[model samples]
Target: MQGPVVTARSARPTVMTDGARRHLFNDRTVARYRHSLSEGVDRVAERISGADRPFTGMSPQRLAPEIAAIDLDQPLGDPSAALDELETVYLRDAVYFHHPRYLAHLNCPVVIPALLGEAVLSAVNSSLDTWDQSAGGTLIERRLIDWTAGRIGFGVDADGVFTSGGSQSNLQALLLAREEALTAAPAGSQLPSDRTELLPKLRIFASAAGHFSVQKSAKLLGLAPDAVITVETGADRRMRPEALERELARCRREGLPVMAVVATAGTTDFGTIDPLPAIADLCEQAGAWFHVDAAYGCGLLVSPTRRHLLEGIERARSVTVDYHKSFFQPVSSSALIVADAASLRHATYHADYLNPARMVEQRIPNQVDKSLQTTRRFDALKLWLTLRIMGADAVGALFDEVVDRAAAAHDLLAADPRFEVVTRSHLSTVVFRYLPAAGQDHERADGANLYAREALAASGEAVVAGTKVDGRHYLKFTLLNPETTLADIAQVLDLLAAHAEHHLAADERRLVRR
Candidate 1:
């Protein structure tokens, strides 16, 4: 009987008073959403803190099939109930990368401050392409470019733009290098219609151990990926200077244009660093573009201890740096920097809406003049906020921490007779695998290690990655977490070694059964 007081329409929406066509989201709704978000975050933090148990493995897929069965029709019921189902169905199975033991990839443990900056950035939705849209955001991003360039030793003339990540940065570097290569060609000979005839038998050079990205960049630039002349490496896994010089001589004699020489500050798979200073001299002597892909290793710039590792980085005409990789910034914080901002003129194009030729006359600093993207993200904010909060020295020290921790992990694993380290630890990766003493050979030991790793992941233990090093298999630990203690690494190794031993013994038992 009390329920009879209910009105036909329970309540009026506040936005309707202003004669606005109704939006599902109103100011009050947004306020509620913010509160809900805060609540959810607090709950997550508490859940993590409440955990008395350690993570066992991260095997990737353990969800019920019904949850993932997709039908595109819009839901017709209470939305909150549907969302709850989805959280358990989909998100529950997702790898918790932030879990301290999930030490698999280059993706770092993102800092809390950077996450806060990102929330504000997503709301503003400023495109960095135009100063009109971005305003203060543009200035902040430019300052970051300047600060990074100065670290690379590119004085006065250095300028760069924030990119999506290393791949995009590499593409832009090669684009500029291609533009520089055709310097003497007819004015019209450029990308969008790069005059093919003007293009020489252009060659790029890099170490054999350089990331596949260097070759990929070459392919994207209209050169065959295989056309990149490979230089043999010495025992340290660095590009041999003599082999590089010999190749340069051969290219010159064959009337091929030597366009660029790429040097890796830290290679992807093995963490190998090509000898930069020696490579720099070769590039200078050959009059080739010296492009350094320091995407993984550029953080060394701020590291007082490791700064010397990248001594010749300044000689690079252009460089790629991924702040996300080692700077503890969120993902997609990468930059492509050139020694002279004028080099960016090559990437400049004219469209009625974008960087019109008239704007160039006014000397307006349109980011579109240098960027590969029309609609780009404001990725610079996270890195800018991070650097500002921690200072250069602190960030550098964190990188030092990664390298040091990785070395300690290597020492710990090496001390155990059960682990066969394929390569001595370098950078932040330790390449090794469990080795059983008697029953199995090297091949079977590798198999056991691989299976052991899978079992570890399947059991929700610790996630460790595997890779081939020098034609042999290995279990690799790529550390980006500065807080990852030696004890943490030791526990994972011990678990892995124990698992491999059990598996090996089982294999031996199976053979005896046969």
Candidate 2:
């Protein structure tokens, strides 16, 4: 093995030779990063091509000791040796989402065009915080934002900024809504000397199926715990317009300010879209801000056939779209778009060292002025590259294929006697649980279903997710992989049934022993 390369000719630090400086800096000529980058890519490619399963099925107990043995104080000093150690320590056991059997979360196998953009963006290291920091990069990001706004059918006054994820986007949206509400309140309604008092009378409304981030945002915004009022849902798990209207009327009678009404375009577990048109009308009548969390369903913007699902979305004052979820892009590709661009001024913070007022007067585009983050990544490149190469229609087709597969899988589960499938999929998720045998009660059924999900995950032949509906445990199939077929889902279902049966048999044995 090659030892560490040393070029120091003298012991004194200030008396460095030309070769030592070159080696330390690792410039183009000295370190040959081109070769190093190629090697790293090749290592990951080899790992992907050689993997036998989606996961290694290794328990944390066995992996912890191996990871703890690494000595961080001393460097490995050799690139090839470090790569070998990385392969053994991390890559061998990492959960590969690209595998056909992995249907756990909203994670999608990234597209090739996005990968190309990632490579270039990382190499260039452009920060989209200010216009001077990233001249052309700023323009590219703004142009992409404009294109997204146009697709959402927003008017000419619409504007937005990219965020870290759906959570951040939602938080920022609520912040703007709160600011807008405070600005519009009658004089003396809020004590300017003590604005915290207004939090008590402020309220936000969302469906029972809306993202948990709604309540989280309320908490973060210093509103009371009861500030978020969850409206009722019908049999379809969508928000009932009558329930929302009644709640709005009560808020008015109680002197509570309806700050905002959050509508979900696609929920997390069931993928159910709330009644956006009715909700929009209610918000308009109540004079409350309307926000749509379309993080998981924004892909329908380009979906040729399913575009009607997002009909009333354009009416939202602000909208959250996570391109990473449904656009086949990698993580952290989400934006918070607003219908009225002036609402974004609530997030602006003027700093003399960065985005100054002078720059704004000059009409120079500084993304930091509209973003919650100061130093943001150039994530727009990923979507730009995807649109340029694969075209938006191709991406939409892939999403449509997954939705179609999800429908077929729902039928397969519903037809099976062993499973009690939930409602028909509205987007691309099928919520269901394993049904116990005829003699078992509700408690036993829940236990058996929970055990089946846990056992399957431990076995690692297939990875799935679990959630609770109506206070009972249920498993979920979040189908985002277009390549995954019905056979794959059938095999996974077979595994789940076998595991549930094993758990029940073991429980019976325990009872007999007792």
Candidate 3:
């Protein structure tokens, strides 16, 4: 109506200047990308090579101010300059998990093949949600899922999706179980059709030693506050089947529906695996969904000699595995595998613009349909590359080495007069504490142990973890690094003992002065 509102094309300069254009990653900037990445890699390599200990003892109080002082609004412009700034803020004091003395958590030193896969995946930037977006990425992830399911002894109906970590995997597994419980109300049971009315009656049974994520997942699923029933564990820290049987009976008598029974394949602190065979039998009798959080003990799946440790895991409805923990992959590589593929439909939702219901009918494989996350990374590439290059047996051997190291460490602590070890783990964790003089009271011992952990961390000599066992403070050595030898464990133990002794002596002097 306004005469077509014609506009003239002006000869204006583009906003993307040559310098800014050079910063972009494209066909033309391949050399720049390679050079920049090489510089960053060199810096990391230098840090790893120079680090004498696992940590620099950089406390938050000291490092926080240094980080907060930086003017992030001011860009360095050059990648090398930014990397140099990173060295001061991050690389210099970063916890080097590759260090043999880093006996803290389930962090494993990554393999080269996985690192290579990381580089490629980051560059490609594939979002593994739909077939159109990911193409081969979808297939690769599916293949990996199939391979993992096969290893898990899941039949042809098995399916799964990669997740951010173990927590998310566990959360999704419980979510699926919750949905199943709601829909498949027992033949004569009184489960309300409305979710709100029935949600309060649902209960999850997990061992006292199981990961806290179970409780967290239950909360997130809108279950009651006391929804998670803690089943007692034996002296070995494994879930007692007898205790579970009694709990199941109690739940039945109380008219509470057993939604899921979570079994820990490898717990966080003690690394003790629950009695899977017995737990599986109990879950079957109770008609509860069986889930195995094999985040730490998933290595046993590949272990040539120790595969029997996970005897009844094949019967689990769902399982969580963290490749980062035992397979030596990089951080944030984990999966949730389910024996029945149909259960994944609980997580699927069709969006018209994205994965429409028609896509499924058309046989278009969209990973988002089965995943909790819509925009997932191509993390499967790392494990794929690792398997292709090193093979599963090689990865399992590395895990075996650490398991052996942990067993040796347990023996070392058991024989030591200055230390007291807890239950021996079938996996790779040893919980112990430095014992002071026999005259010291429990309070003094606890204070000394706490003081020693803090002091040792402050000294930058080594890094270890602390946990409470039976209301008493204890130290934990989660041995995931295969390079950590018995000598390294002995040295760290000596350091801890010295620090504890120093604390006790200082305390005694203070008492005498008082």
Q: In every candidate, how many clashes are there?
A: 4, 0, 0
Q: List the residue pairs that clash in candidate 2.
A: none
lDDT for residue 449 in candidate 3, whole number 0-100? 85
- Tens digits of per-residue lDDT, candidate 1, 1-514, equal 4555655465654454533332234565686557656765665565456542234333335344554564547552444555566556544445555666777778887887788788778767889987777878888889999999999999999999999999888888888887787664334433223447546467888888787776787777887545688888876777898999999999878767677888888877667678889888989888888999999998898997988888899999999999889788887789999999989888777888867788778877668778888777788888777777878888889889989998888788778888866455457977888887865566787778788788887776678888876776678888888867888888888889888888888988988999
- The segments of candidate 1 whose C-alpha lies over 4 angstroms from its true place after superposition are 1-30, 43-67, 70-72, 75-83, 184-200
lDDT of each: 0.78, 0.89, 0.93
TM-scores for the candidates: 0.88, 0.94, 0.98
Candidate 3 Cα errors over 4 Å, as ranges: 1-18
Give the alpha carbon lDDT tens digit for every residue of 1-514 in model 2. Answer: 9977666644346634543454442345435566667788899899889876678787889999998999998777667888999988898888887888888889888998999999888877889999888898899888888888988989899999999999999999999999988778777653343457666678999999899999999999988889999999888888999999999999988888999999999889888899999999999999899999999999898898898999999999999999999999988799999999899999999999998899888998889989999998999999999999999999999999999999999999989999988887678999999987888665777888888877887777888989999999999999998989999999999999999988888888888899
Candidate 3: tens digits of C-alpha lDDT, residues 363-440: 989899999898889999999999999999999999999999999999999999999999999999999998878888
Error of 2 at 409 (Å): 0.6
Would you give me the overall lDDT of model 2? 0.89
Query: Worst ten-residue run, lDDT, model 1?
Result: 51-60
lDDT of 1 at 341: 91
Q: Report the Cα lDDT for candidate 1.
A: 0.78
What TM-score does model 2 achieve against the real structure? 0.94
Q: What are the clashing pairs of model 3?
A: none
**How large is the C-alpha RMSD of every model relative to the true structure?**
6.4, 4.9, 1.6
